[model samples]
Target: MARIKNGILGGVQGCIGDVEGFIRNGEAFIRKRKKKSTVPRSVKQLANMQKMSVIGEMIHSMTSFVALGFELISKNQSFSANNAAKSYQLKHSLQGQYPNLNIDYAQVRLSEGQLPVAVNPIVNLMDNGVQFSWEIDADQSYDRATPRVMLLVYAPALKKSYYTLSGARKNAGTDFMELPDSFKGHELHAYISFITDDKNEISNSAYVGSIGPAFIEGRNEAEDSFKAQNDDHKDVLTTKSIEHKDLLIPAIITIDDIKPEKVVHTKPNDRFDKRAKAVMKRIKK
Candidate 1:
């Protein structure tokens, strides 16, 4: 609303259409309004929104660790660590179409820096916990040993993840992430990285292999579908209104819906085929 201070042609006091009015040094001034795009969102824009939604939700589950993981990378930047990592994941980690996107856990990175990454990383399921071990690089410097291992374990079905910002030292060669009793029967994905003791520097996270079943999300739903078809002759079928006994009416269909002639081909979903084969090799005894 722009109010005319004087009769008809004086100073404007508020906003009008694409401009705003203000009084500076007792002088009336108007500023042009910033324009907003009125066009419909493009296909790519919608796809990015879907990606952001999926990644944002997952990252929120482990925000504390994620924030610290990219702390240094986000230093002095406009965005926070969480957004930095999210931006990175949005570009490289997500897979599949708009509504059916999934995170490529193997390519997902928690931290980024110049420090050395975990080498020969291995994960194993044992005693209600997952063990993380890596071949430590032979850099005996204090900086190398000062870097501690950071670990993450994610349970997709549960949509919950647990991580250690600072766990075992890089030289420890092994670390264990104890899972709660609830994690026992679930499939898991693990990632590992290294951060300095002072949390100043970090290494790129490595995919520490997955254990348990390579369960496909949402596959647990009932494979077979049932559609009930029933027809009625309206209210005229009632005993009181049965004057049209000569008329043909549809019979109420009560069927089990299973066809004896129909055959369902159960395609093998064995660890997503050859991909799971390679992941299986990463499993250490």
Candidate 2:
């Protein structure tokens, strides 16, 4: 009986050990599966973060573009009118040298007291090539004797590089620059400086912006038409002046129906005839 009791206790102990081992194995398997599941979740979270970052960048870029467009359009009308007036004045001043000369002018207006000059949404093409136009208020009182205007253009792709020039004029602007054929897709920027005869000046060197590829649809047709008219005027001057010299030269000699020589002569063919003959002879010689 004692042996049988001992055998039963031992069997019970072995069964408990076997159950505990099975429980331990099951726990380990569950832990391994949990870890495996978490790896995919981690990868998914990382992917989501990357996508959000890309979206944020895109939104930022688009917002900048929209803002720039709005600013350009809003100030364009007034700026263009002002520039046209100034150009008219300049042309009027230069009329003696260039009788048939005129300027086809437009302006890119900025917001009241903006840093950079306003950029035209459309690209401007001139005789030289494509360029931009903007209005700049003179910083200091320009001297009538030696007024000075300064213009700066920045090439966006080449970093902060710029082109600068100085001249005499209170409200002078720029024509388009000749761009290389390979520079079709590049960007450009513009700034303004005004210097007075006293050497006092203002420089807004921080003014910076960007340009883009020229769109065929955005060409300034009105400006182009104005240029065409001016060109036609030039062509007329070149071609028609030789045939119409009488229209160009004023009549210096006026002839009256009554001959002055005949009426004023006291002695008919006396000294007057001799003087007239001598003058004629001198003229012929």
Candidate 3:
């Protein structure tokens, strides 16, 4: 094949008109002609070619593989770039080539790092339930990609956790979650993770730490009542009381009727007074 540069044919074949095809720049002038080679390449040559192939794969997998002359600012940035590069390659590989590639959460988190930032989540005590808000590192003016916020709320007392996701079209930037009455009183711990619009990227997660009901003691009468009840009964009914009708019934009794002189009161007695009173009342009747 001869390359036609400036109307001049270059590269040599075997004969004159035997130049069966010609190529100009990248465009082929004619159909491709196959040439047969009888001599086999040396083992060293084949090994070198295989090594170079892997090198190319590594380069393609590196997110920070600048052409040749450019420099990057930080090593951490370079490392993250490399991860991004590897992720993109994996994504491409799985699209049509390899459909069975295992792209799980760990891989996605390592590669894309696409999650948004959750900053200064405020857990406010409210009257009816719990109100929460967080500063999302998101903007309404840009990006067609919607924001998704996920929360994992746990109550140590309940030994259970609740998982939730933001609604469709909700911007996480100024988003908030209003927990139902089930979250009231008992201390709760929470953490948040974010997803951008494409669902292909995610950000690192942030722990909101442990937060009690928005209605803390002295904050409101309801909270004060909750604390008073919790104090009087060490294993007081938690917010889960909503699930059990019997638990929802507030304790109703009067220790004021007990003649103070008739009973010997101690620290333990003070602590178990309610229980003892209930037991004694049951026994008396």
Candidate 4:
């Protein structure tokens, strides 16, 4: 009986040793596989790429949400919707291309008649010498290819007065009519109309009242100096306020001035001075 028990014990010990060895070998194999997997540069790059892609998707989602929110807010507020949406789309697209891009306010304020107030007017204004600009979020994410800017001008006096000056097509911000040379001496009333890229649009004509011919109010220094040097120069130095008679009147002819019964006086070239007609033609072409 004692000998049989000893043999059984030996068999059991052997089996336990075998099992321990198998476990050690399995652990080593697993460690080796893990090391091999991580050591390959390509594998590491692929992992990083996946991580970036995921981050980009997250960013895109977040930007899209924000853009939607902006649209809603714009609907309620006086903000430009088209510009806002364009900016949002631009940012998301850029983020997809480069994960770290960000967006912030990059708006350019433009008055009805004057140069755009923010940034360099020359660069911000369109090539046509018009005052037009876009309000953008300064996010590096905004697409460089498709900037958000659109403007329209409505002139009542021109034969064809409604013109769309879309920034997407061409730079037309600087294309405003040169203050008419004939208006150089007078205070002219100009009605300017505009709409932003975002459906946040408005078309009430802005009346720019009385822009005058360029003039200097101060006395002539040259004449004053000459007067100081000569006794007779006093007569020459007598400064008179030179009023430009042309500028004294309203730039646009009033309806009251037109005799209701009389045939409306139309110039042979009735459209010669019509800037709106010119703009409309250019847009159509």
Give the best candidate by lDDT: 1
Q: What is the C-alpha lDDT of each candidate?
A: 0.74, 0.36, 0.45, 0.32
> Which residue runs does candidate 4 get wrong by more than 4 Å?
1-129, 158-164, 168-285
lDDT of 3: 0.45
Tens digit of per-residue lDDT, candidate 3, span 158-254: 5445555543333544434556555667877665655555544455545566677434434777777966765675444233322222222344323
Model 4, span 1-285: residue lDDT tens: 012223543222212321321122112111121224546456557655654454343234233223332444455454443445444434332332233443221221112222122222222222222343323334423322232233322222221122233434123333343322222223222223333445343232233332332222333567676545554432332111011112211332233433344433334355534643554464467
Worst 10-residue lDDT window for candidate 3 reads 65-74
Q: By TM-score, is 1 or 2 better?
A: 1
Candidate 1, superposed: residue stretches over 4 Å from native: 1-42, 214-285
Structural similarity to truth (TM-score) of each candidate: 0.60, 0.26, 0.33, 0.19
Ranking by lDDT: 1, 3, 2, 4
lDDT of 2 by residue, 1-285 (tens): 112223543222112321321122112111121223444456556554444443333223223222222333334343332333233234332221222332111222111222232333233644334554445445633343233434433343433323334443544444444544444445555434334444433222223344444334434778788667656544444322222233322321112222333333244457655665654564467
- For all the candidates, what are their Cα RMSDs to the real structure? 21.1, 27.1, 18.0, 28.4
**Clashing residue pairs in candidate 3 (N, C-alpha, C atoms within 3 angstroms):** 63-82, 114-202, 115-202, 115-203, 125-214
Candidate whose TM-score is highest: 1
- Pairs of residues at least 3 apart in sequence or in different chains that clash in candidate 1: none
Given candidate 2, what's the lDDT at residue 117? 29
